[model samples]
Target: MQKLLEGLIKFREIDFEEHKELFGQLSKEQNPHTLFIGCSDSRLIPNLITQTLPGELFVVRNIANIVPPYHESEEYLSTTSSIEYAVNVLEIENIVVCGHSNCGGCKSLYASDEVLNEIPHTKKWLELAYEAKTKVLAEVSVEEVDKREWMTEQVNIVEQLKNLLTYPFIREKVSQGTLTIGGWYYLIETGEVFIYNKENGLFELAN
Candidate 1:
């Protein structure tokens, strides 16, 4: 807490002062162009990784960067609401769903029921990635846990991207070519990003 307080003071004293003009303009309104959906991992900083400034990327961080399939009857969801605001209200054109290496949420998907019972809510939420896990398992056996986990993380990103399309407005914009979606995988130790290439159906290192 002390460290965060000190950092807040420093932000006001130095960083904020240095970017006073930019912050002043942003204080009026934010018109971010991209909606960045990333993991709630502290190591993954969306703006820092993309080298974007304030008011550039509207971010939504959640466990495993999951995007629940859109349902018309569902109401008052933080992720779904924010995504609607970003697309319909803010008119954001680009959306990036980023997944990182060594994610706790992804690893938890492989946890036994007894272990998952320790964290009920977390276990329930991770059900969003079950499809990804199932897809991986259909092709590979449990003996290869490491490969399964890695494939789960990658498949989860693409699965989330697919879920994003379940929203009517988002689908409309995408169909009209006004909005675009992207899936990204970040390697924490190497500081490298891989983007999903739809043409090749593979993740390739970002150029």
Candidate 2:
């Protein structure tokens, strides 16, 4: 709490002051061009990773960076609602779903009933990544933990990219060539991000 308070003061006195003009303009309105869907991992900072300025990326973060397939109901869908607003309202040009190496959320898919029972909501939420889990397990051996870790992370990004198309508006925009969609696998330790190539079904280093 003390550190956060001091950081707030420093930001107001230094960072904010330095970006006064940018903030003042943003105070009027924001017209972010990209929608960034990522994980809630403390190690992955979206703004820092993208080198994007404030008011540039509309971020939606959650466990595993999952995107539940489009649905219609009288439900409070947090991530869904954010996607709706970012696309239908903001008219974002690009949607980037990023997954990272050694994702606990991905690993949680394999958690036993005893462990997941402690957090029922989280267990339910992780259902979205089951397809990715199934795919990775089919190809990787249990002994190859490292391969499974990265494969699950990358495959999960591809799954979410497919899920994004489940939204009708997004599908229409993509079909009409008005909107672009992509998946990214970020290596936290190496500071490298691999871009998912849909045509090749592989993650290529963004070099």
Candidate 3:
């Protein structure tokens, strides 16, 4: 409330003046460079982390940063629709799917059935993580619970990247070399970012 109002006042007084021309151009149209799909986590600020100015990255955020596989039904999914527009209309050259450390949504996927059942919608939504969990369980043995959660979070990024390709428009662009897809892991504590290399099937620090 009050703090947000004050922030707006400061933006009007200082920040707006600093970037007035950029804002004016943005008012006309936005030709963002990348489509950034990320989690709804407050700490995961895509623009701030990527050092992007206004109108640079078209963003679509959701719980767990999940991108559901393409469906033809009448259900209107805001995230998928936004991604479709970003790819088909805006023609963004790159799409980055970012997953972060200590993701509550991913952690909840492994919770007890009773706990998960309490949030029916969330549990249903998190079913997308099943493949990631299976992969993690097969590849990594977790002696501690926290490590298991973190591993699942990392694998979830890869899973979502695969799911992203399920869209026809995205697949077409990717095949034509007009679009690139990336999987990223952001570690909040270390302020480090790891990018998945399709060639290696591993996330290496972005250097």
Give the TM-score of each candidate: 0.97, 0.98, 0.96
Question: Which is the leading candidate under TM-score?
Answer: 2
Ordering by TM-score:
2, 1, 3
Return the clash pairs for model 1, or none: none
**Every candidate's lDDT:** 0.94, 0.94, 0.90
* Per-residue lDDT of candidate 1, residues 1-207 (tens digit): 999999999999999999999999999899999999999999999999999999999999999999999986555788888898999899998999999999999999889999999999999999989999889999889889878877889999999999999999999999999999999999998999999998987999998
RMSD of each: 1.0, 0.8, 1.2
Give the winner by lDDT: 2 or 3: 2
lDDT of 1 at 137: 90
**Candidate 2 local distance difference test against the native:** 0.94
Q: Give the Cα RMSD of candidate 3.
A: 1.2
Listed per model in order, the count of residue pairs whose N, CA or C atoms clash below 3 Å is 0, 0, 0
Question: Per the 3 Å backbone cut-off, how many clashing residue pairs does candidate 1 have?
Answer: 0
Cα lDDT tens digits, model 2, 1-207, are 999999999999999999999999999899999999999999999999999899999999999999999999798999999999999999999999999988999989888999999999999999889999899999988778888888888999999999999999999999999999999999998999999998999999997
**Ranking, lDDT, top scorer first:** 2, 1, 3
